[model samples]
Target: MTHRIQLAGHRWVRLVTRLAVVLLLATGGLVTNLASTAQPAYAHAYLVETSPVDGEVLASPPPAVRLRFNEAVSFNERSIQLLDTNAEKLAIGTPGHVDGKANTAQVSLPTDLTEGTYVLAWRVTSADSHVVSGALTFSIGHPSATAAPVEQDAHRAVVVVDAVGRALAFLGMALALGGALFVAVLWPAGRSDRRGRRIVWSGFVVLAAGTVVVLLVQGPYAAGTSLAGVFDPDLLGAALSTRLGHALLTRLVIVLALGVAFGLAVRHGSPPATTGTATTATAGAAGAARRIVLPAVATVGAVALPLTWTLTDHAQTGVQTWLAVPATSLHLLAMALWLGGLITLAACVLVPAGRRETSRAITLEPALPRFSGLAQVCFAVIAATGVYLSWRQVGTWAALGATDFGRLLLGKLAVVLAVVGLAAGARRFVRRRGREPLGVDAAPAAAVRRLRRSVVGEILLGVAVVSITAVLVNTAPARTSYAPPVHTTVPVPAAAAESAAGLQDASIEVNIEPARSGSNVADIYLTGPDGSLVAVPEVSGQLESPDRDVPALPVTVTAAEPGHYVANSMSIPFPGEWVLRLDIRVSDFDETPVRVRFTAR
Candidate 1:
């Protein structure tokens, strides 16, 4: 029996130690990748058109370069750069809106730019506050086969700090909103509990600090600047002009309001009263506050705080946005209340209750029971909203395992399930041990210790949830980010039969790889009706974007194998609907067009 007990104790210790290690590693490691991905920008804002275009051989540098995105984007002077063949940064004009359109940016190119290859590296913040970066190279006179790749992405330190700031903000929000609610409203003796109040107060301070950090870091993150640029006035101004800036500022105001409300709620050291006021006027004032004032402010602040996040994140952009926004807000609120409340409960009530036999024989009574009930409701809301959100963010069943976003979500869910299981066990302990009215305090010391350990596990798991959530929120949704390669066949034009003298039933098989913005490769196979190779005189193509009013870009198709043709350097300008028009010449004078339509990510 002693051996069994000893093994169990060791297991518990190991579990906690492992959790602590995981928390540290995940927080530090995952944040570094926020800005380093190659292309298919983090948010939906994609570059649909570029002046001079990628790979265009020009005799002279254009007076000004223009870029059009599918959606609004925010950038600063440092966001766009001219890089020489050696990956050296060159002088360029400040990036600005084209025709005063937020979706388009224009920059003046130096007329003295020498001949050779040059890369235009651009990093911009989408409306949802995610940074998407890609490089497009255009040659002044001719392409450089040996041109170096652009290494001008956001500095690693900047991305790490930015991610850390975001994580802190998420943690602080939970404490400010959830912790405050627990200290002021959940526990009866919470008002005077120094530790509990301190935790709640610290939450407000951390939240404010975190918000400030993110605000400061935003300037550099969006501009792809070094950490020192965090305080640059111009960078700061550029960041503030964005949608996320507005949201962050609104959040600060709400935090102040909520903090005041929490302070007032706890000011009445003695629990709220009905007959405590001596005079009629004082009584009436107290009654109004108890019934109306505090609740109104607290309610509004709680509801609005989540909106500040939901509105700015990807949540507000997709289908069922009206429903998505509210569901996400509720999901966030429930998370805060449950996590913050649990931490307070453990620290103020359960911890102080003590496992020592000589400790005060306090009845568990209302605090434990009330919180258990609240937790149940929170879990229900979390479950319902979680399901809807999962479906909304990851549309297909295969995506669950196929995409990074889906896999991360699954990891979060696994941790959440573990938390739920622990919470249930704790609930059972509370009900079973508290049945004698003396509460869990009346039960065996071993039972009480078990309860405390279970709560600790739940708390640790909750922190893990928040850390994963920090990374999860920054990533593009699985549905929007996942793009399968384009594969399809288009029928050969009838005009081709008259020249080739074949008859009918022939088709062109088209394949495009990593069909995203930037460099791509496409393979075209001319197959006969009998599924044999059939050589053609020439196969030339151009890409057309039907969704926009832009001109079709030329695509060079070279022969491969007997019947196969390859567009070895196809560059898709953006993520959207596109058509690859292949003009095949069966005979010199007789040619026909074959259009293979597909979507690019």
Candidate 2:
């Protein structure tokens, strides 16, 4: 009788161990699959380049101003505008029209006008529905001004998409990992415990469902489609062609493989006594084989998911470049362990069982210590890696306050802190009570209940963290600037040509040189004759032949130095030849008209 009893006990232990291993495999596979599926969301839209360069001092204004974006922009006239120094409208024809082929916009200006300052104000609605805008200044007859505006729509959209994808990946990982840990520690003793089975199965279902959502949503989000156009094939194809898409595809394959592994484990994990001796032994061995094989496959999948992302997504050069790829990988792994572990604990361990023997001895008692230890290790890994990744991505302390990316990161940190607090409380409760069950005692029941609640809370916060992460990925780093500054020097002559009468014929020489400040601004210098600085006064002047009757446009000239005048706020009225006549008064000469002609084209 003793021999028979021992044999039965050993068989039962084997069956339970097999079930636990299967669950662990499933968890690992699900996390790897989901992690691969997640994509990065951009926060701001990026402008590739522009014409009539920001702050450019053109000899003559072009027919229209053209701006190009990295991605498609929302089409709305109100979104793009042009104004003068006094904030007057200068966009001659229409606000702007999109160039279908280039994915750009063109805003036309009026034909004839006097020299003056002009402002281009633009607002664009990105494919993601976020609105972004900026302003630039340009001058006429002066050096090109470089004053590129700071625009964030395209970049912001990308960041937001990235955050969402990462968060979903994290959430899926947490569910799968937590579920696996529970089954690994508890199911070995309670393979037939209905509640324990439900927990494990439920986690699998949630993980699979989450993975599906990530796969479907990621492609559209990355391509910057409107919410309504998310299902467009062109956008989807474009997204898939990028590195992010390939990573997601790899993740799907891993997840499907894991699902198959889980099914195999469950198939062989029957109650020991339900089958004949020969069948039971065969099933037991098969189950054991699957346990090893599935988890091994899952481990490979996990490694591949992050490795692909590291090689394809992040920048791999500079002082902190070496750390970027490794830190990102570690960050992903830690998140998976923490989230997956919690999910498993809630679904497999803490759930109530029907029979006292099944609940206490088979499920709760054996699983508690194992899960507690695993949770501790996962928490440590998460904390260590999170710190390193945060440091590299965020850089300076001020970035937290100065940039959108940093702010989103800070929000994620807050969520993590809350999860840690809940986890700590659960750990303390588990430690205080020994694994041995108190017969009919409510203390163990209460502790299990508390742990379940804490795990659930952690999952909720994890969701928010993911959302913020998506937003951050789309936005440009706070330190990144798209526009450059403007620089110019204008020299005027000092001598005047006077008639015999009091009236003077002032021959003024206006020297203009336009240079770019940065990527956006155009700096131009305009000097008059008489070897003295001359300003483009806010008055109307006629260009002799081609633009004879055009009114003098508003001009704003700032004195850069003692004898140099920089024209920042001005626009050439026409592109053709024009004779300029400036009326001025020197220290000793009466007011005189200085005439000069230059081709604007």
RMSD to truth, every model: 11.7, 12.7
Stretches off by above 4 angstroms in model 1 are 1-43, 146-148, 268-280, 283-287, 352-359, 431-442, 490-508, 523-569, 581-595
Error of 2 at 70 (Å): 13
Per-candidate Cα lDDT values, in order, are: 0.77, 0.51
TM for candidate 2 is 0.55
* Per-residue lDDT of candidate 2, residues 1-601 (tens digit): 4345446546644654554465455445444653453333222344545676544556776677777665445444444556654555554665454645324777777767346557676666443233445555666666323333333233444444445555555455545444543554334743444554455455445545544454555444443344543466665564564444555555555555554544444443343454466556655664565557556655654554455445434322222545665666666666665666555555545555653445254245546666667768877876787777666555678667656667777777888889789878877776666543652123556666676688789767766665665455445544331111222222223342231222132223355322111221122223333434434322223324344443343345455653334344344432345444444444443444545555432
Q: Ten-residue segment with the worst summed lDDT in candidate 2?
A: 514-523
Tens-place lDDT per residue, model 1, 1-601, is 4344444434433443343344333322222222122122234576777886766668888898888886777787788888887878889888999877878899998889888888888888886778888877777777777676876567888877776777777788888777777777777777877787899888888888888888898888787778998879988887777767767776777677677667766764322333322333344444465456567667767777777778777776667776887899999999999988888888777774545235444455677888898899999999999999999999888778877889999999999999999999988877887678677667787876788799999999998998888878878788877667778988777778667855267888898987777778999988889998788889899998888765677898899887999999898877778999998888868878888889888
lDDT, candidate 2, at 279: 54
Weakest lDDT window of 10 consecutive positions for candidate 1: 30-39
Clashes of 2: 93
User: lDDT of candidate 2 vs native?
Assistant: 0.51
RMSD of 2: 12.7
